[model samples]
Target: QSEDDVKTHKGEDQSEDHIGACRGENNFERIPVAVSCAEKPYKCSECSYSSKSSSYMKLHLLTHSDNRPYKCSECSYSCKSSGNLNKHMSTHSDEKPYKCSECNYTCKWPGVLKKHEVIHSFDKPYECYVCNYKCKTSSCLKTHIRIHTGERPFKCSECNFSCVTSGNLKIHLRSHTGEKPYKCSECNYSARTSGELTRHKVTHSLDRPYKCSECNYSCKLARDLNCHLRIHTGEKPYKCRECNYCCTQSGHLIRHMRMHTGEKPFKCVECNFSTSQSGDLKRHMKIHTGEKPYKCSECDYSCIKAGTLLRHMKTHWRKAKLI
Candidate 1:
């Protein structure tokens, strides 16, 4: 009787082990085949779409919806991912953690710093298939592609100005708004843009980097040299559509156009007197304010305009008071 009881317990243990092994095999077969096959290519668990590269999957996730989970504390900036938001925060802090391996150029963002390093290394992996043009950045190559297509995606809302990039359109909008955000720390003068402010600062430094090929005349600003070159070339780029009046400078052309249109934008702030030109209005305002900006180099004589001072200097050249 004891031997029969021991034999029955052993038989039950063997049956349990066989059932457990079968259950394990069934679970292994029930596992999703797509998940196992997707091990080679990354698949977004949230969406079933699989991508060959992980970076493409990340970029594709942004297109699903307006999922801007990352927020910036310094400004009203947001991004779809935490990594992008972290990169943007560096701009506000002015912290450049990324340094170029080849040069002294540093950038707040790693992507920009990598692009700068390519310049020193002269590594242009991105190339145009249509042309001989090549660029270190894929973004730059995409922009160059627009040159072949003649695509001007950015357009000014205020005017007919159009550009290939949104950045150029932003600069063009300053002309309409006259918004000068760039100011000189040394002086009270400001400019519409940083580039203009930089050029204005060069005047204070008296750094005449641009020189004329024809004469010894030099100017700190490139625009001044371009205008000076016009003198040698006699190239009149500005022309009056109303009349045959032509001028080298756009301001002079604008003033000439006023003669035909009888349009005077400048008016005296004190009196109701107005003039067609700003210089005329400035001279007229001196009558009310009694401000003389021009001084005679010869004598203590002062005048409102340089032309008036020049006329006053003529008296010194002539004999004493006329009989």
Candidate 2:
């Protein structure tokens, strides 16, 4: 065989003696000829992954299969690879050895720290085709693409709840399991997600780090500060599709949309009462409990709603004006 017809295991040109030895009739050490110099011959049918190594291609194929041999002892978490199972096991503990240099961020995995470090840098290579959104990693760009495409791949078995990312689906599953993995160090308070725990931790501290430049208003969370700034800026970003109604918050827009759809999502467990808003459902619950929180100072009139108490006070005002 010609020198060009055979190559070493490392994709390198070998000596004539080494090539002759590999060319033996019963030689099992004969390395396969590479298809291209720079191209990866092994390609995945499921995804865009490609590898030059045959063993790596075999390992990558496992990602497409439902055969997960490795399982977690603490949870229902399972994976195809042992390395991934080892990484997931660290999440059950509070041990975070990897720390970010730019911030107080710490994670159990080195790859997570590497991803977190990108936030400190101004470089964002991945850009969205539909929007002006840019992110540091390709994984983040993939998640952002789902926003424009409206593709929710991760689904919940318990409900119709579906999300774009697996991380979001994992958090949503916690609602059914009643699992609060993130806990507050100062208090006994716990939260389903790290962001919720972070917001809760601010309540323990007296200092309000997020302050509004337009006003003297300050808040523990940056989210609240942004919402407060919308009041001064008149930036009603959340708009109703059915009507010309616009709102400062997404929750307000969701509630407004329910009015258009006539969706009574908040239903009373005790009675047949149902409402579009959660607060309305809460007030309905008070009726079943016989809890008249709103009382009139003029008389023994009491009600479940504040609006009823305000109307009762008007009766006193009318009597005083007549006197």
Candidate 3:
């Protein structure tokens, strides 16, 4: 063959090799191949694909399968391929492999680090085709689109509740079951949701992470902080239709409605007695069970009812001369 023809044949072979590599063949060793920046690329063997570097070829392969062969030596972390492993190593090295052109914040992974820098740059690259809402990531934009479409794919088998995402559905399930798997070791408090448990745990740690933007009142959770902010703003959005009673929380409004409707949802199996609230039913149950769950922290005084315990605490205060 002619020399030029031979070179053309070699280029074709390289193109085929790249395509095979992209299709998930571990053909190339870690050896680097140098090519001129201006040279036209060749197509892949298995598909119509071309890449400037062999590393790009390997990354493209990971998209086809769920294989994570590369692992982190420092931790039990693994990735679908070697390129991801290289990215994961940067985290342990404290290396900012990815940088934002607009901001100074650096990240270990190029994708995540790129996202962080977008906040400082105010760059909304991913725009929702349905709405004007813009997001930094395509995934966020896709999720937002569901709101417009009213597409709730995630559904709770136990209830009629449906959510746009699986994560939201999982959170909704806690409300029905009242299954609080997470508990605080320091306190008797527990919560059905992890977010609530996390907030409860913060109370033990004395970590008021949520600070009011308007005032000095801080709370362990963002919801508590929001409610506290309403106190400063004098915002009572929840109003009772039956009475002139106004509340800051929707839950308070719901309980107030029960008083007007004479609706006792909580009932005792042992007796025909019913109460408007679950807490009231629980306190009443103590009359039958003779369980004194509430006790005075100061003295040996204890009572089945929390109100009685409060009155008992006052007696202790009176004895201590504090009140």
What does candidate 1 score on TM? 0.43
lDDT of 1: 0.67
Candidate 3 residues 1-323, lDDT tens each? 98867876666434666655544455333222344776424334456566666567656555555676787776666668666577546644534567777767565566676556656756789876643456787777776666545466787667444556776775676666564545566777766554676666765676777887776777777677767887887877555545567767756766676676676756686899987787988888988998888888886767897778888888877888964
| Best candidate, lDDT | 2
Please give the CA lDDT of all the candidate structures: 0.67, 0.75, 0.65
Clashing pairs in 3: 19-44, 19-45
Top candidate, metric TM-score: 2
Q: Tell me, what's the RMSD of every candidate?
A: 15.8, 7.9, 13.0
lDDT of 1 by residue, 1-323 (tens): 57767865555334555543533432222222223433535455566776655467657667566777888786555668877787656644535678887667676667666766666657889887755556788888887666445466787766444556776676676666665555687899877655677777886896688999999998887788988998999887555555666677756765676676566656676877777776788689888888998998777889898888888988877846563
Model 1: weakest 10-residue lDDT segment is 26-35
Steric clash pairs (candidate 2): none
Model 3 misplaced stretches (Cα beyond 4 Å): 1-191, 201-204, 213-215, 293-301, 310-323
TM-score, every prediction: 0.43, 0.61, 0.40
